[model samples]
Target chain A: MTTTLDMTALDLRQVNTRLQAAARAQANEDYVITNPRGSHAMACGLDGPLGVTIKGSTGYYCAGMNKEATITVEGSAGPGVAENMMSGTVTIHGDASQYAGATGHGGLLNIKGNASSRCGISMKGIDIVVHGNIGHMSAFMAQKGNLVVLGDAGDALGDSIYEARLFVRGSVKSLGADCIEKEMRPEHLETLAALLDKAGADARPEEFRRYGSARKLYNFNIDHADEY
Target chain B: MCGIVGLFLKKDDLRPRLGDMLTDMLITMTDRGPDSAGIAIYGDAEAGRTKITVQSEDPARAFADLDAAVSEALGQPVTLTVVDTHAVLIVPDDRVAEATALLEDRGLRVMGSGASMEIYKEVGLPRDVAARFGLRQMGGSHGIGHTRMATESAVTTMGAHPFSTAPDQCLVHNGSLSNHNQMRRRLAKKGVFTRSENDTEVGAAYISSRIAEGASLGEALDGTIRDLDGFFTFVMGTRTGFGVVRDPIACKPAVMAETDDYVAFASEYRAFADLPGIEAARVWEPEPATVYFWER
Candidate 1:
């Protein structure tokens, strides 16, 4: 069943309360939200297998901390969209602001348009795909996950990164302290192809390059402490 | 956090609704900032006249017969229009220096002076401030409004945003400056003084001083990128246009939307949701360290 939720007629608390209540019920329903009006924290903290679609743009922290619910924004998203998602898929049809996906344990964040600064920071196991450009300091200190960018990246991509796999199809302005471009093997290309297919991106996997940590900063040595 | 809103109209028909549009945009951001509110409007500039906006703690006594007194003292006709606790005094353009000194002698705080710009601000909610000044009824070509949360200064009337330090120029800030004290001392040595201890006032004075030294608006904004340290998203209004710039880190959020009829800047897209034809506007986040300006 598809449920329609209108924001103009209800306050922010009431709107979130109904969504949260439905998520707890695990009804496997589809919810449609209209007149989002760039509100913050819409469709956040869902832990069920529901499908949620926001008709318009949203403000900060949209679809944050989701477990199994799939949420989609038809318009642009504000700062920190899909932050710290445990699992599920969050897709933004338009542009996203700063820190598009930060510190997520698991999930797939697909951005169709550009993402501003710090697109993905400190992700534990999240999979992020950006069809457009990402700003500076993306994938900073990333521990584990796959970040794929099909467009140009701004300054300091993957600063002080670790274990996470980064695939970029375009030019990188600069690399961070411990980040370097590693040769893409067949297994990496296979992973990129699968991610691209899942995100419905039009680019080919072989067109991209990969970046990851140099593994020097994993163990902190006093002599090299400045780099850490 | 603070909220800033700016509108620069490309079409002449939208000029008359400038204040109404800006007031709606400012009020939508009330949740972001509730400590103080201010708005700067660029209205029609009468030939050979400079409008000085002054604020008085006690308007009844301070503004009573003040225009007559200034006219008698300066031997020139001065017209005063009082609204709430603020008043705009129209004086001959050539006598602005003499008139400012005379008004200061009587203890009236001069908010700003320019050919077309008139500023109104107070230490209250944005909604209340707009109503107190009847901002919706006014009209203008371009304007900037600020709803401040008071991070680096006290919540006084003088400590509000939209700080105007130069003629026909005003600025609204959304972030704090780390090197304002040092910059203040540097500008002071060059005879550019700030009236408030607020950090944003120092930023306003810095830009004004640079412009006074013959730097273009774009050059002055670029100077902020090179010189000022800390987070900031500033929207400045001039006689003919407005400019926007953000710090390199861009920790403070800024969203801009442009249509054929107008260009708008807000701290959040929520502020732009109510604007006319916003769905078709080209909305995007401004890149860090980039300067964007629109001139008539």
Candidate 2:
């Protein structure tokens, strides 16, 4: 079944209530939130399985805290979309704002367009595949996640990293502490393919280089004190 | 005008003494709130479960009101016992909103609430703040704390750091907003009350109003950043850890150091330096228009 919500006239509260109701209606069913002019918080905090599609751009926290669902934004998303997510698939068709996929534990986040600064920061375990460029501080303080940047990455990528793997296709401005470029293996290429397939993007995995932790922060010793 | 902190275990296992260290660190930053103090720690009581502490001018009256309100709101008798003005409430599960709204509605500002979470201060030196708040010995996982110097507004006990802009959201600020007065006027036009003259409170209100209208913390903050003028180093803590933002060209200093082990922050690097156990911590300045957040 399909539930279409035209948000051109409804306010955010009304939209949220209606969307929540729709999400609670049918498992694995698809619902659409459409607005000729983009508004904020299109799909937030969905706890069950449902496919949500925002036909146009969204403001902030679109598809936040999703669980066992799929959400696709036809246009851009503001800050903190897919934030603190548990599991799901969220695809942003256009450019995205800062802190995308922040603190997310699990799921697949696909940004088909460029992302602003702090993309995927402090990520826990989500797999984020950005087919375009990402802004500064991408993947900063990432604990455990797989970040695939198909284009350039700005400064401080993977700062204070822990176990997260990064793959970038274009130039990198800077690398954060304990983060360094690594050689890509066949397994990594397969992982990229899996991520891209989940994101429904047509990018190839061979174009990117591998990045991971330097393991310097683990088991601190007196010799490594200066880096701190 | 508010501070907040919380901790969430990543792998179903938390670091031993991590919560306690957070408590110690939170108490260290008690200067951020000079009006009151409180802590909430989560875990084994012998180990500790999210400990929460609060300070109030009329501690007895606020406690009485909070107890009654919590009981009325939660359909259970409130029994977070206390001795003197300060007490640690074993906040019942799911009763967080009930207690918080009750305290805030009674005009008692809640600075911090989480594991070893607290908002502690009382017209005293930063060095002596812990002792004054009965935080002589306490510990918990990652939490947040704050200090305040209410300018252009009355320094009443209720007007302290960790100003709750909404239920479960609190923030602290270091610099003034040039457009707060105008923003306040506009917000008033929209039927949003100007609760206090504090710009930080207005800032929190701005975010809360957005959240109520469906703006996530990050989106509301990012969307409104350009609209807000002047300098500010806003430090916000919710049920999560600290969330920070800086103005394009503004006042206030923020130095932070992040590690896979822990992320300790302060207005100045010296505060982290002031921590008894935080040696060899990396510190740096956040870029302008930059936003940072922490989750425990």
The best candidate in terms of lDDT: 1
**DockQ of candidate model 2:** 0.01
Over A159-195, each residue of candidate 2 has an lDDT whose tens digit, in order, gives 8888889988899989988899998899989988888
Candidate 2 deviant stretches above 4 angstroms = A36-38, A224-228, B1-296
Q: Which regions of candidate 1 deviate over 4 angstroms?
A: A225-228
Chain A vs. native, model 2, TM-score:
0.92
For model 1, how many clashes? Answer: 0
In candidate 2 the C-alpha lDDT for residue B290 amounts to: 76
Residue B87 miss distance in model 2 (angstroms): 56
- How high is the CA lDDT of each candidate model? 0.93, 0.67
* Fraction of native A-B contacts kept, per candidate: 0.76, 0.00
Per-residue error for A34 in candidate 2, Å, reads: 2.2
lDDT, candidate 1, B59-78, per-residue tens: 99999999999999989789
Model 1: per-residue Cα lDDT at residue A146: 95
